[model samples]
Target: MSLLRRLVELLYGSDRALRRMLQYWAATCVLYVVCIGLVLVQVSRGMTDGETAHRLIVFGSWGALAFYALIRASARLGLKPDQLAVSQAVFSMICTMCAYAISGPLRAAVLVMTVLIIAFCMFAARPRQTLLLSIGSLAGAGGVMYWLQAHDPLRYPPMTELLTFGYLAGALLATALLSGEMSKLRSRLKRQRRELSDALETIRVLATVDELTSLVNRRRMHEVLEAEERRQPDENGTCIALLDIDFFKQVNDQFGHAAGDAVLRSFSIAARASLRANDVLARWGGEEFLLLLPDAAPEDARHVLERMAERVHGMPVPGVQGRRISFSAGLATRRAGEPFADAIHRADNALYQAKEAGRDRIVLA
Candidate 1:
């Protein structure tokens, strides 16, 4: 079992693309092995000629070594399957042509292997490469047939070789056409996958982010609060705040909704900049936001909010002249056993109190 596993691992390496390339080469190698066996069968029948020696020694012996070398190079170099595909097509054709040149009576049957090579390259090579290989195969086979017929008219008759090359030519050109179609399909599928990925990313943003202010939406905020509640509250303290823009409706009524939107957008950006790295500020609804502070002491959280208030008080909105952005907030520390929703409710109550007392101030819950 261990020996079998090691051999399998040697042939098909650990990398996915490497494994696929090796598997393809293994299949091609098997074709050579099968051809070698047929050559042996011919030799057993008393055919001891240079043709037999060439097949067994050049193709059978040296071909095996080259095959192993190519496999090792592909693994070590981390070559992709597509790159190795072209190399394999070129290498296999050379050995096939060399063997075909001397096969004598086996020349007719050897054309089968030639056709197979063309078919394999049709799928593996790019469209232009497939066209080139197709033309090369037809030309190479025609040249070899003409040479053999002229040299050994008794063994390779002119009429028989012509008919055989004609058949192989038809097959090669037909496959080239089909290969062009397959390449088009491959390109289209890749484009669709990229478009689908982009669409999915857009959908994710819509689900979790507020398109208006680009903050976490109310739905995603609830998810964050629930996740935070499941974990233990920060040791220093976990605080949450509810904030509303002071007299926001008056701004909208005076300046129209466009200026109101610019104010909301500017406030969200400034508030986010003033918050801590671990803090989260989410859009709760229109004119209201939620802020969650983790790993912050009450005093530290208060100071953070106070700094935000000072920064926002005199900040100008883009189109709203003579008015600045200001928000009222209520802060509360989560008790050890309290649920997040309950803490947020206490914070909400304090926010109402802050509004009644005066807007643009922070009240503790």
Candidate 2:
């Protein structure tokens, strides 16, 4: 059992890691294609040997297909992005070393490109994995260069001794600058995405939340109720409560709308505190509120509302000194197969009864 649990955790962890890694890998693949295309455009224009050109094209196509398949398979296995990025970086380093070994004159360019690629991968991948890949790529490059120099010294003469090392230095410098610019671009893009997400969330909150009571607005309440109904198909057994502040209009006329708003806000806070986390509370309109209690019977809903009313009545508003805010609540349980509107209507009628019988009490219908 312990071994099985460990295996499950390992699999889940790897999946999460791969998902994070895959995002970076996707970006890296785009950059890789761009670089390869540039090289191909430059080299292919002068090539007359159909056989050599065909071989080059075939290798490039195969490389792209292989990378795509590997990435797709990883995604299918539910790998997380981070793990995918690290794995791809390692694979890229391996391929870079292989390419350097197979090609002679292209070794300098490949070496510089591999270094830059590895550096970018390191910026995105875990520290340990990045270190391992960097070391492996460097060792592989050195080994291949050594072997080539030993076999054919003339073909692999030291570039440092020729042309004052200007070309080699220039290539390395350009690679470094390009890698740094790419890193900055990635950072800027990530920041922009985060800011946009935050702005959208803010707009959503403003649309769905009431500014005065801090409760959900009417539209949001309907959306939530519908979602809950779908989740709990037997919601016919659920209870709905519609509450209106008793003498709210009288208070508004006597003390002004500002005081009325304060009373409303205070009552909402108290009522919310009196309910459970799963219970829903919303501002149903001016001086009115609604509560939806899933899996609650009529008796239970009444008890909950009675408690909420008592709490609100006991709450003291700053401007309404020595005066308590009271509300009449109507409680109704849905009958089997009853529509949402009918249940609300029943609750509203019960609320009217509460106001008529005596204010600040729960009436069940």
Candidate 3:
């Protein structure tokens, strides 16, 4: 039993407290059947009467029903191993009391079942629940045993004299060991799960973000835009703004491509800072960006872009060589019946108008 306990601890770690409790219940059931079978064989030898056999079968059937009902109830509740342990412990106490009533050598079975229950409660349930259930199970079992002895002295003397004291001591010792192991395993599993979740979130962020500008990349931007487009014609509104750096190539030619890259990155940071949390900013390509604005009208988008342009102009970019960095923006609002492509085309044309009208401004078509 000590070796088995050690092996269980090694295999399950701390998070497996609930699992171990369920295993204990299952093992108890199997052991009960074997013990009952041995009793039946010995008690029925050379007795041609079917009366004893029939009674034993009836008792076994009732026990089976009780076990099945508890298991089914636990499963329905989505009971974790820890919960199962508490439930099974309660059920085991009831079974032990019933055994006392039957005047059977079910004493061994009840003793084993009681010990397993205590182990589960101590190991699987939370500290408060463990203390509560353990005390409750112990008191309940003791009360039932006392009641049985009072009601029918002959039927329960063995339980009071032999089974009760031995089982209680065994239960307390087993519970102490199981509880310690279970707590350790639970702590370890929690740390492992937290680390795993953090790693997954980091991976997701890296996949969707632009490394240089720290904005959503082109692919992620498209995905977000498409999702917004699908949600249109609903109560919430949607708009897209296409922005291009005005005379960006001139800056690249005069200063260097590195300086031009710095300007693009700085402009992206400014644009992102100017937008609301719901707004999605992404690098569309060289010197171009797309913003998907949910719950925004063409007027609202125009206001947002105007604010973004103002912020960009205010920012200092070393690559701009003493000149202010500026952009042309096209704003398009989704019509109730219009396709996403049509809205995009309208925004593109509006952007052209902004460029055509001496640049550095927002144009709404």
Return the top candidate by lDDT.
Answer: 1
TM-score of each: 0.87, 0.64, 0.53
lDDT of 3 by residue, 163-197 (tens): 66556755755575667678778889999999999
* Collision count of model 1: 0
Candidate 2 minimal-lDDT segment of 10 residues: 160-169
Per-residue lDDT of model 2, residues 1-365, tens digit only: 59988865553345664544445555666766765564555456542234543455466556656655666576577754446556666666665555554444555566666666656664665545555655565556566666766777787665522332345445444554555567678789999999999999999999999999999999999998788767766646688989999898888888888889989889988999988768999999998898999888778787788789778878988677667788888888877767677889999999999888998788888
Tens digit per residue, CA lDDT, model 1, 1-365: 59989888876767776676666677787888887766666667644365655545575557556756776676577765556676677667676666676566776677678668756765557888887887887888899889988998888799988998899888778878888888899889989999999999999999999999999999999999888877765433799999999999999999999999998898888888899988999999999999999877778888889888988886778889988778899889888878888889999998999899988899999
Candidate 2 to truth, TM: 0.64
Q: Which model scores highest in TM-score?
A: 1
After superposition of all CA atoms, the RMSD between model 2 and the true structure is 9.1
Off by over 4 Å in 2: 1-13, 18-160, 232-236
Q: The CA-based lDDT of model 1 is what?
A: 0.81
For model 3, the superposed segments whose C-alpha errors exceed 4 Å read 1-109, 126-179, 233-239, 247-265, 276-279, 293-300, 317-321, 333-336, 349-358
- Of the two candidates 2 and 3, the one with more favorable TM-score, higher being better, is 2
Reference-based lDDT, residue 66, model 3 = 69
The residue-level lDDT of candidate 1 at 275 comes to 93
